[model samples]
Target: MTTMTPCQSLTIRVYYEDTDFSGLVYHASYLRFMERARTEMLRSLGLDQRALLEGAAGAPIFFVVRAMDVDFRRPATMDDLLTVETEVLAVGGASLSLEQRVSREAEPLVSAKVRIVCVEAGRARRFPPEVRAKFERLLPDQA
Candidate 1:
């Protein structure tokens, strides 16, 4: 299991492609932002997905969204510099709970709790020991 902690911030500028009609970002785009933030966070921790999939283990790991709860607090306008903040909420045997947020000027525009199940061998499986060992290094005291 995991517990909440301060998140590492990833700031991205909103562009036209991220927006829809009325000059606001499309709701689904927030998910992409959060995904990128998480990916970069892992990279900073040296867990490169590409290498992980093609390494000596030769096992591919992908995440499948299992559950999501979102709240649209405010609309994100074009050209806004937004930040995605992610925190690990809990780690199950085969999945993890994450809290992701999209913010502008430090104010939250959207927030979500996302649950993703790990996939290996084209099927859902508990995270392997190697993966767990790598992730544990990034966790807080209670992890």
Candidate 2:
């Protein structure tokens, strides 16, 4: 199996609601777009978050963002077509690191590194074996 993970991209059309009074996209709006892209990234890997969040046998599983570092490099104005690209950077026993970027074609608007941790019963927990195996496939070779 290939160790490199392909970047996942989600297109977003900047709307009036996503913009501030200055007509530029709001900073929080980028967060929303990035969140959706990351969710889609997991979905593309065959991990259904809705089902996982609902859980089976009353075992609720969820992923929570542990930290995030964002860089707002450029601005995206209203009606801009933006794409959020996401890639897995690393994986741990209970945490995953990801890099995400927002761009308008060739112009980068924002970049972020996020750390997410798996949780069960409101505490950090090791990912399930199935989930671990799936994410492992996306991890780059340690060597």
Candidate 3:
């Protein structure tokens, strides 16, 4: 297995709109947060989801989540600066394992592991050679 530092990361503030009736971020909100981070991470690798989906960059490609296990350890209140961290934990022929966490002051509020399959036309397919090569280049050096 290999780990890839998010090619990019976008930090965001927890706003009132992100919370529920109790002012605590709703359970499903974390999924949106992770999605944003993951999208940006792919953008950093030069894969623009919008362009791809619009056919400007080619056939629409997506990494559909095949499975995910998330743990909600704590609640994040409004006005908090939450950092969403994403890392590529493993790369496979047609799928990758990603690890993500939402943190405040180095404390984990949530952590999740997601398995995503690379797809085109709704069928799982291997990533392009160039994309896989680029992803390898994003990995930290071996020990």
Candidate 4:
């Protein structure tokens, strides 16, 4: 198993709209939270996804979700303050594996394993060298 570095966390306040009839957060809402955390993680690493998509950094590239496995552990209610934490698990030539968890004050609510692939011109492509280098820095020491 790969050990993750310190995670990037984003706090979110649950709104009424994020809940279903039971007042529990809708399952899909967790996806949005995790997505934001991942984006913010990249931003914190000095990677602007929009620039990459617009080809400002290099050839146009987009990160797309290739696969995901999510486990819904606990339920959250409206107005609850939740923290979404994202960490890099693995960085590949053209893909990244991440682990994200949503928690309410240290109690885990949701956990996910996500795989994202870099695509250029609608096909899989290697990550830009700079982007890969930044992600590589997050990996644990091989020793």
TM-score of each: 0.85, 0.90, 0.86, 0.92
Question: What is the C-alpha lDDT profile of model 4 across 57-143, one tens digit per residue?
Answer: 689998999999999999999999999988788999999998999999999999999999999999999988888988887765521
RMSD of each: 3.8, 3.0, 3.9, 3.9
Residue 39 shift from truth in candidate 4, angstroms? 0.8
Clash totals in order: 0, 0, 0, 0
lDDT of 3 by residue, 65-128 (tens): 9999999999999999988988777788888888889989888899999898878888998876
In model 2, the runs with Cα more than 4 Å from the true position are 1-5, 56-58, 141-143
Over the stretch 16-54, how does candidate 1's per-residue lDDT look in tens digits?
999998899999899889889888766665566777666
Clashing pairs in 1: none
Which is superior by lDDT, 2 or 4? 4
lDDT of each model, Cα atoms only? 0.78, 0.86, 0.79, 0.89
Tell me, by TM-score, which candidate is best.
4
User: Global CA lDDT of candidate 4, please?
Assistant: 0.89
- What shift in Å separates residue 86 of candidate 2 from its native position after superposition? 0.5
Where is model 4 more than 4 Å wrong at Cα?
1-5
Candidate with more favorable, higher lDDT: 1 or 4: 4
Candidate 1 residue-wise lDDT at 141: 50
Predicted structure with the largest lDDT when compared to the true one = 4
Model 4 reaches what TM-score against the true structure? 0.92
Off by over 4 Å in 1: 1-6, 55-58, 140-143
lDDT of 2 by residue, 46-71 (tens): 88887888984146798999999999
